[model samples]
Target: MTESRTLYGYFRSSAAYRVRIALNHKGLDYTQAPVSLVKGEQQAPDYLALNPQGLVPALSDNGVLLTQSLAICEYLDEAYPDTPRLLPAEPVARARVRAIAQAIACEIHPLNNLRVLNYLKQELGVDEEARNGWYRHWVELGFAALERTLANSAGPYCFGETVTLADVCLVPQLFNARRFSVDLTPYPRLVAVGEVLERLPAFAAAHPSRQPDAPPA
Candidate 1:
């Protein structure tokens, strides 16, 4: 029997969202320990002990501590090989998916995450409009590249018909883009694929609005 899984994360964190999608797609049952990033709860000494980086999405699987969203997702896949695979079998295809996922997770997300935004406002003295402008700029750049990369999609998901790591990463990034009011008109392929992916059970359940900590509508 698989051991119990516990995920510590902020509801609205894109990185945490990616892990949630991976876990749901694999049909894994995990408990959530909400870390309120907005309130700086991630920095608490207790939380920091769980994750020295003080990042959301630190996971504990039967007492095996895991940090980093991508690493945790890959670990789940490796540990539970019987579950649906997030990375493809073919080498080239797997690399391509990783590239796409990283394009957002590494390049785009780093510049626009909560800490960076707070640093821009509190440390750099950037105004609201300028801070948002910073967010929109990186999102547009990343989406443009992703749109072109996915121009050859066979349909229904990021990598052909199967949901891969790319799709998991894409959904949360797009959600963040919309949250920041970034214009998505420039990336039709992204918008269309995202709409389809969001309809899936795994993706839908992992949405920020559906998370337990989300504010009431």
Candidate 2:
């Protein structure tokens, strides 16, 4: 009824992955409506109407359509503030959490997303090696800075003892990095934080591999 919400997302989309982590962290109940990116299901007329940009992680909540991963997460935070808050109450600390989140979402992810990679191959005529190089280049550049940020933070989580927006963003980006064979040795702090977060039940449930639409082995 009034509380019902549904998420339209692909299993492997990191943007969707971020929202999944946020939902799990908040312990929210929702229905998943898979949008198969590899199969181009996102471009279907129904989904396109839901998101004109044809992006995954679009949420339909209380009859309102919301798009963009970070914006959706913030909406969830605002709508359900009584649950565990994703951002710190202090303005400065909240800014720090958001800065870390954007470091991945704004800087790292867009450059290596599926659409961007597709453009590199179809339009720019990039070969597989060049595409992978593009992926690694951005991941490495982002991770280098993230490693330093995590080193300065106090915790098993990104911000502090409790999970925050930064951890939600970090875990998924690290997942992508490992999938692409980015060496983790150079970023021990980031790896350590990810390991700690991975052990938590919320994060474990949000992993792409565990999603219902995840590709078969």
Candidate 3:
């Protein structure tokens, strides 16, 4: 039997969103322990003990704590292999999926994270215009490359047909782009893929707006 699991995360955290998608995709039942990043709840001592980095989307399963969104998603995939697999079966295809996922998770996200943006404004004294410029710069660069990658694939999803790690990564990043008002009209394939993926129950239920911690509407 699978051990009881809990996830500590913020509603708007893209990293946390990735885990939520994975959990739903795997058909696993878990509880959410909301950590408010905007209000600085992630830095509280109690939360700090769970994740020294003070990041949202930390997972606890059977008393084992796991941080880092991608690692946590992979752990879920490994621990529960029977349900819909997050990674592809073929070696090359799996690598391709991982590559696309990492491109967003590792490259684009780090530069635009809350802490990084705070640094730009608080430390570097950047104006709001410049800060927004920084955000758009990385997102456009990443999406341009991803658009080319997806153009070659058959998709209502990122890879062939099934939702894989790439789709999980893409949807959240696209959400972030829209949150910041990034013009997505240029990346037709990525936008199209996201439109379809967002309609799926797994993706729909994992949306930030639907999370329990989401702000009062």
Instruction: Please give the RMSD to the true structure for each candidate, in Å.
Output: 0.9, 1.0, 1.0
Q: Candidate 3 lDDT (Cα, whole model)?
A: 0.93
Please estimate how well model 1 matches the true structure, expressed as its whole-model Cα lDDT.
Answer: 0.93
lDDT over C-alpha atoms for residue 191 of model 3: 91
42-63: candidate 1 lDDT, tens digit per residue: 9999999999999989999999
Locate the minimum summed-lDDT window of 10 residues in model 2.
1-10
Q: Give the alpha carbon lDDT tens digit for every residue of 64-108 in model 3.
A: 999999999888889888989989889999999999999999999
lDDT of each: 0.93, 0.92, 0.93
Instruction: Report the C-alpha lDDT of model 2 over 2-98, residue by residue, as the tens digit.
Output: 5988999988888998999999899998889999999999889999999999889899987899999999999999999988889898999999999
Worst 10 residues of 1 by lDDT: 152-161
Instruction: Show pairs that collide, candidate 1.
Output: none
